[model samples]
Target: MNIDSMIDESRIDDMMENELIGFISTDMSDEEVLAFIDELEAEEDAREELFDHFAN
Candidate 1:
C-alpha cells in the first residue's frame, strides 16, 4: 500500500480543525501571543495585525 493510503486524511483534518478552534478560543492569551511574537521578532505590521486580532 502507498503511504498516503495508510494515513486517515479525514481524521487528521478533524483533529487539526479542533486544535485550531481550541487555540483560537482558549489556548493563548493576548499577552502570551504578544510575547511569542516578540520572541520571534516579527515585523511591525505583522505584530500590529496580530495584536489587533487578539484584542478583538
Candidate 2:
C-alpha cells in the first residue's frame, strides 16, 4: 500500500513479464517463474510484517 511497496510489486510484475534474463534467453518454465513469484510474495510479506512491528 505504500509507494515503495507499490513500486516493488510493479517491478516484480515487470520482471515476470519480461520473459528474458538479459538480452537473449528465456528458458524458464511457467512453474519456475511462478515459484520465483512466490518467493517475491514471501519477501514482501516479511517486509510488511517488519514494518507493522516498527509502526506499532
Candidate 3:
C-alpha cells in the first residue's frame, strides 16, 4: 500500500491531538529531537517491512 494513500489531513490532525504526540516538550535539545525523529523513522521502517512481508 502506498503510504500517501494511507494518510490524510484528518489522520494528521488526529495524530496531533493524541496525548503522547501532543505532549512533546519544546525543551528538548536539537540532539534529543534528532534522536527522537530517528527512532520514529526506524519504527516506521520496521512497520513497512512487516507490511510488505505480509502482503507478499
Predicted model with the maximum TM-score = 3
Which stretches in model 2 have alpha-carbon errors above 4 Å? Answer: 1-25
Candidate 1 shows a clash count of 0
Q: In candidate 2, how many Å is residue 25 off?
A: 6.0
The C-alpha local distance difference test score for the whole of candidate 3 amounts to 0.61
TM-scores for every candidate against the unseen true structure: 0.33, 0.56, 0.61
Cα deviation of 34, candidate 2, in Å: 0.3
Give the range of the ten consecutive residues with the poorest summed lDDT in model 2.
16-25
Off by over 4 Å in 1: 1-7, 25-56
Expressed as tens digits, the lDDT of each residue in 1-56 for candidate 2 is 78977886687567645633442337777787777767766766786688668867
List, residue by residue over 1-56, the lDDT tens digit for candidate 3.
Answer: 46653764346445434633754578988887778767666665676677668767
- Candidate with the larger lDDT of 1 and 2: 2
Tell me the TM-score of model 3: 0.61
> Taking the tens digit of each residue's C-alpha lDDT, what string does model 1 give over 1-56?
44653354445446555654555545689897566545444444455577558756
Worst 10 residues of 1 by lDDT: 36-45
